[model samples]
Target: MSFITINNIWQEYGDHVVLERLNLQIKEGEFCSMVGASGCGKSTFLRLLLGQEKPSRGTITLDGKRLVAEPDSHRGVVFQRYSVFPHLSVLDNVAIGLELPQSPLLGRLFGAKKRAAREQAAEMLKKVGLGHALDKYPAQLSGGMQQRLAIAQAFIMQPRVLLLDEPFGALDPGIRKEMHAL
Candidate 1:
């Protein structure tokens, strides 16, 4: 059996049909990519995988179980638009997702635990070429920097599946290639 399966999938909005009778199966450790023109259902399919959208008809299963309505920690996403926390610094923004799921209290980690989370967030930001902006808020960063910050935030969570929707759209080719390397 495949690790991820999409069976007889169809997505529609009112009178418009985006995807029709699509069937796909991906086994464990396999890599998959979808390519198509604009307005195609690639984004829709990704959204379905991310649990951001439900198929009009059919099922999408992961590891032999069906997907739930709400998105889970098992899946991570970096959207095309900016998804940073304007109120928080870059370090806090990146560490927040990782901190929340593991923390027993109301997303608060103190002392060494807090320090470790911040250190990890800083390292992730450095890897994504946003090290210098650690103290800055999301508003201070440029579009590409903001996108990189978002990527760092999502990647730090170490989710089972990472879904990126035009994640590098705002980055220059050189920086995009660098991100691909990381």
Candidate 2:
């Protein structure tokens, strides 16, 4: 079986059909790209894969498991809009997934395992070429840096699948190409 499968999928918004009978199979560790005109359901497809939305018809499965809800840990998503926490430093933003409270009281008093999470976040930031911006807030970075930070954040979890929705669309052509190369 395919690692990721979208079988006979259909999606609608009221009377408008966004996707109709779409079928795709993606193998594990494959790099795939989908290009089409604007408003052609690309974002919808990503959302479906992320389990942020459900198709009106048909099935989506990952490694033989049916997707019926917002998937946990197994998927990561990056969007054109910056999803980083504005108040957090780059390190904190990238480590948010790994810092879920062990206990509400412990998190409140001890700050959620900062050392290890920060180390992992730093490593991911370096991988994405944002190592120098670790101390900076999202507001302090340029658009390209912010996007790279977002990429680092999504990838730090080492999710089984990554979904990107126009992740480089906001950048200039030059920077967009650079980000694509990373």
Candidate with best lDDT: 1
Candidate 2's C-alpha runs over 4 A off are 101-112, 170-182
List TM-scores for all candidates, in order.
0.93, 0.88
Ten contiguous residues minimizing lDDT sum, candidate 2: 102-111
The 10-residue segment with the lowest total lDDT in model 1:
27-36
Q: Pick the candidate with the highest TM-score.
A: 1
Per-residue lDDT of 1-182 in model 2, one digit per residue for the tens? 68998899999999999999999999998878889998999989988998889899999999988985876789988986868889999988887767764434544224456777778889889877788888889999988788888888888788899889878866778767766776
Per-candidate local distance difference test: 0.90, 0.83
lDDT of 1 by residue, 22-129 (tens): 999999767777888988998899899999899999999999999988898888899877599899999999988778877968887878988999999999999999
* TM-score: model 2 vs. ground truth: 0.88
Colliding pairs, model 2: none
For candidate 1, the C-alpha RMSD (Å) to the true structure equals 1.4
